[model samples]
Structures are given as structure tokens and as C-alpha cells.
Target: MLSQVIRYDGSMTSPSESAPLDGDELETWSALATVLEWLPPVLDVQLQDGWNLTHFEFGVLYALATAEGRSLPMSTLAGFANSTLSRLSRAVVRLEKRDWVRRSTDPEDRRVTIAWLTDSGAEVVASAAPAHADLVRRLVFDSLSAEQAMTLREISRSIAAAISDEGGWRPGR
Candidate 1:
């Protein structure tokens, strides 16, 4: 069923067209697909259990924490987080409710909004980072040989580059 150039009814497909995987290709794809399905939820569970943060919320905070002046424009943050503005805004509202983050109109551009991390937010990230990092190491790094880690980084980046410009929802405000 996972073939090209041959349909289930025994008709032929275009030879130049891509077909579904079979044999070793299918096995490799299945393994990669499993990892893709499993990793995010596992990470979310860890963050939610340990820090009361979803993986996405943590990613947003972590991005702000590393940004200069602990602030980034909301739109830019949304891009960096690979999130829709609506989702980022909702998360910002939650973060604001916690007093961990605050928003301000950009001084140079009134139309632009900036998300600023409060001292409390910085402190929270500082407290949470070690545990999160330890979990990452235990789950990912500790299991890989140095070569495999390098290969993984390379393969992942390559795959990302291959699809980075492909079609996807590009939500705007």
C-alpha cells in the first residue's frame, strides 16, 4: 500500500512522483515518527509536573530570558516561538496574571507591543532551569554517544531546513 508507480488496484502512478515509504525507508520513517510523537508530550508532562508550565509557555519564557533587556516585541516573540499571535497573547495574559511578565508599548513604535520579563520572571526561570536542563540531559543527551548527538543535530537541522519554507498556517493578528 505504501508504494508509488503502482496503485492498490494495480494501476501505475507516475514514476517521477514521490511514493510512500517501504522497506528500510518505512522502518526509518516509523522510528522518526514515533520520536516526533513522543518527545513533545513527554517534555510537556515534565514541565507541567515540575514547574506548572506547559512546554510552550516555558519556551516563551526561556526565549525572553535570553533576550536583551529581557524584552521582545510580541510579534517577534510569536515568530520565535513558532506560535500564532492569538496563542502568544493568551499565554502573555496568563503570564501577566502571574505578575511574571508585563507588556508595554514600544517607545519608538507605538503600534508595536513588547513583552518584558519582571524580576520575578527571571527568578522563576533561574530556579526552574536547572531541573529542566537536568531532565533534558537525562532524557536526551545522556542516552546519545557524542557522534550520535552530533549526527542528530545535523540531521535535525537538515530536515528542518528542508521544510522550513513549506506550507503551514501563517496566522496574523
Candidate 2:
């Protein structure tokens, strides 16, 4: 059983000494906080150390790989990668320098620029994918039973919806 602790005047107090919260509500909030604290660094280390890519860089490559024609408009790519345009521009410049991505004006709209993953970028992503998948499996999926995994997926979807309804951050929006 989980017990609640209350903080009062810089001291910790028992739940009985404090006003109540809905149990499920409290659990949901706590779980979200805990996961946020843990998940990012775990993902970052795998991307940074193993793949020589930052989390955002990995996201960009992954998004391009899954996108139509392995490309997207720079604006859309920024949104998909949850980065500001300037930041994405810098990242794309870096990738361009490495010959991993190419930038070009959209054929139908010269004013718009598109980012396309080069063959080298695709190869890098392919090489990194297995290690990334292994990390995800180890850090997340392997710990849960099949039923629990399904439940987690449902719960995460519901929470994501609630967060989005509240105007929370959304990539590719």
C-alpha cells in the first residue's frame, strides 16, 4: 500500500495531518513526476554515448526516416523534433557539414526549405536503432508483463490526451 506524506512548515507530516487528495489523482501526478525525472537522462545517455547523437538529433533523424520521402519541410521538421526553428537550423547545418543531411528549396515553393536525410544519415540511424531499441526494452518494456504493458500504453495515452487538452507541449503540432 502507498502512503501519502504531507509537508508543513518545512516538516514532513502524515496524511492524517493534512487535507486529502483523491488517491488516484495523487498517484497519477507522482508517477508522472517520477517518470519525467528518470526517463530523459536514460535516453540521453544511450543516444549521446552509444550513438554520438544528442536526444534531439536522434529525434530529427528518426522523424526524417519515418517521414514521407524521408524528408519534411524545415518548419515541420522543427515541430516534429520539438525544437525552435533557429535550433533546428543549427542542427541541420551541423548535419550538412557532416554530409548526413541535405537542405533544398521545396520544388513547388521556393520560399520553403526542406530537409532530406542523406544515405549516410539513414545508415547512421539504422546502426543506432538497435541499441536504442535495446535500451528502451531494458528501461521500459522488459520490466512489465504483457498485460501491464497494455495497461501502461492505455494509461499513457489517456494522460497524453489530458496534457494536450491542457495546452501542454506537443511535437509536430
Measured over all alpha carbons after superposition, the RMSD of each candidate to the real structure, in angstroms, is: 5.4, 7.6
Which ranges in model 2 have alpha carbons more than 4 Å from their true place?
A: 1-24, 170-173
Report the lDDT tens digits of candidate 2 across residue range 1-173.
43755332244556766566668978987987898899988898888897678777888888998898999999999887777888899888888887878999999999999999999999989999889889889988999999999999999899778866766655433
Q: List TM-score per model, in order.
A: 0.86, 0.78
Q: What is the lDDT of residue 152 in candidate 2?
A: 93
Residue pairs in collision within model 2: none
- The local distance difference test score of each candidate is 0.86, 0.84
Give the alpha carbon lDDT tens digit for every residue of 31-138 in model 1: 999989998998899888877888888888899999999999999999999899999999989889888899999999999999999999888789888988998898
TM-score of 2: 0.78
How many pairs of residues collide in model 1? 0
lDDT of 2 at 164: 63
Quote the positional error of residue 88 for candidate 1 in Å.
Answer: 0.8
